[model samples]
Target chain A: DVKVTQSSRYLVKRTGEKVFLECVQDMDHENMFWYRQDPGLGLRLIYFSYDVKMKEKGDIPEGYSVSREKKERFSLILESASTNQTSMYLCASLNRDTTEAFFGQGTRLTVV
Target chain B: AQRVTQPEKLLSVFKGAPVELKCNYSYSGSPELFWYVQYSRQRLQLLLRHISRESIKGFTADLNKGETSFHLKKPFAQEEDSAMYYCALSGSGYGQNFVFGPGTRLSVLP
Candidate 1:
């Protein structure tokens, strides 16, 4: 079975503070993705990395950046956290050309 | 641009009753469709894909290109089958980003 693990299951940060969300996958998948889940908005992609050091902006990449220094780890960074940024974040990984993706439990971030 | 739409926000049914979750898509070219499920307190998981044409957990979905719809159906609902279902689609070209629907929460009553 494939395992995708997020660094934190829940987090709280003050406004204007910087935040980091880490994800690691044991499957060594080539594709890693960061998404935010909101009510009635579904899962909107924030950023994705296809390979080490290679990153692409998804539909909702504003105020967010990604790092993929290694194949097994992907990190999402928020430049300045705000109350509106509070939401559940999910990480996923998939094999090259495979449509099936495995997701982590998700981190619910609260910005006050 | 590729997009997926799941109209219903919630659906309720009794055990042994048939259930269908409607999903529609808007894509210019051929696209891959998938149904994902997230049970209570569990991480989201893929239920099935249109390309495979196989039934999983007694649930099946058929992609109709003309109608641009991929609706999931099950002959009988089980108590354990209650979960949040999401419809997703991937475009035929370029980046491999997938568009997902808002999702439908299904509740199966005993």
Candidate 2:
């Protein structure tokens, strides 16, 4: 089975602190994505990477950035955490040839 | 730009009843659509995709290109089917990012 692993399941950070959410995929999928899941708004894409060092901003990329220096790992960075930034972050990886996406367990972040 | 829309925010039905979750899309090119289900405390997973043309867990979706819709339907809903359902669209391009709908929460009452 394809596996996507997230670094943390829950986190609490002080406001203005820089935060990083890490994700790794064992399937060597070329496409990786970061999304923030909210109750009513659903999952809004934050950023995505298709190749090593290549990234694209999604619908909601205001306070977040992403890095994909290696093929197996993708990281999401919050420039300065804020209360409104607290959300459930999900990481997903997909094979370029297929549209099926494999997802990680998700990280629930709280900016206090 | 591609977008997916799920009209109903919540759907309620009794066990063994028929259920339909509406999904529509707005995209210029051919769209690849999928239905994803997240059960209670479970990671979101793919329930079905349009290309497969197969039913999963007795649920099926048909791509209506003329209407730009892919509605998920299941006859005789089960209690286990209650979950959060999301419809997604994949654009045609390099690095095709997926656009997901707001999602519908299905409640199956026994």
Candidate 3:
């Protein structure tokens, strides 16, 4: 089975603090994505990386940045966290062809 | 722009009853539709895709381009069938980025 692991399952941070959420995939997939899921808003893409060091902004990328220094790891960074940034963050990885994406156990972030 | 829509926010049914989760899409070019399910305390997983045309756990979905819909259906609902169902669409563009709908939560009562 493909495994996608997230660094933290739950995190709480004070306002204006820097936060990082890490994700790693053992499948060596070329595509990785970061999304924030909200109750009524659904899963909105924050950022995605197609290759090492390559990134693209999704629908809601504000206040967030991503790093893909290596193929197996992708990191989401909040330069300065705010209360509104609290959410269930999910990471996913997919192979070259857009088959099925494997997701990690989401990290529930609480920005107080 | 490509988009997926699951109009219903919640759908409840009794065990052994028929169930259908509606999903609609809007895209000019060819579309690839998919259904993803997330059960309580479980990671999200793929339930079915239109291209496969195969039934999974007695659930099936047919992509109707004429109607621009891909509704998921099952003959008998079970307690295990309760989950959050999301409808997604992969763009016809090169990247194949997926756009997901606001999911529908299904509850199968006993």
Candidate 4:
């Protein structure tokens, strides 16, 4: 089965702290994405990487950055955590052959 | 710019009732539409794609170019079918990022 694994299921951080959320896929997909889910907001794309070492900003990329140093891993970074940043973060991997994306179990992050 | 909308945030139906989830999109060019589902405690997954034109787990979606809508339907709703459904739109433009709708939460009552 195809699997996209997120590093954490739940995380709590203090305000002004740096936060890192990691995602890894075993399918060797060429495209990886990071999104944050909020009530009535759905999933807003934060960043996506189409190839190793290449990154693109999505609609809601502010206050967030991404690192794709390797093919299997894509990491989302928050420069400074704030209460507004608390949300369920999802990671997905998509291959070139299909438009469908496989998602991870998501990480619920809380900033206080 | 491409956008997707799922107007209803919460929908409930008794078991064996017909189910329909509406989705609409706006894009300048031809777009590929998809339905994604997430069950309780399960990872999100693709339920169906417009290009395939196939029914998945008793759910089907049709793309209407004139209306710019891709709605998912099922003949019967089951308790197991309760999930969070998201409509997504992907275009060939430079944006490349897939845009997803706000999503609808379906609850099938016993």
Best by TM-score: 2
Give the clashing pairs for model 1. none
Tens digits of per-residue lDDT for model 2, B44-78: 99999999899999999999999999999999999
Query: Model 2, residue B107: what's the lDDT?
Result: 99
Looking at candidate 4, what is the lDDT of residue A99? 75
Over 4 Å off, model 3: none
Error of 3 at A69 (Å): 0.9
Q: Per candidate, chain B TM-score?
A: 0.97, 0.98, 0.97, 0.96
Candidate 4 lDDT over A1-112, as tens digits, reads: 7499999999999999999999999998888999999989999989998889999999999899999999999999999998999999999988667777889999999999
- Per-residue accuracy of model 1 over A1-112 as CA lDDT, tens digit each: 6499999999999999999999999997888899999988888889988889989888899999999999999999999998999999999987656778899999999999
TM-score of each: 0.95, 0.98, 0.96, 0.96
lDDT of 3 by residue, A1-112 (tens): 7499999999999999999999999998988899899987778889988889989888899999999999999999999999999999999987656468889999999999
- Candidate 4 chain B: worst-modelled 10 consecutive residues by lDDT: B90-99
Return the top candidate by lDDT: 2
lDDT of 1 at B25: 94
DockQ, each predicted model: 0.68, 0.81, 0.65, 0.68
What does DockQ come to for candidate 1?
0.68
Worst 10 residues of 4 chain A by lDDT: A93-102
Q: Which run of 10 residues does model 2 chain A get worst, by summed lDDT? A: A94-103
Per-residue error at B42 for model 4, in Å? 0.8
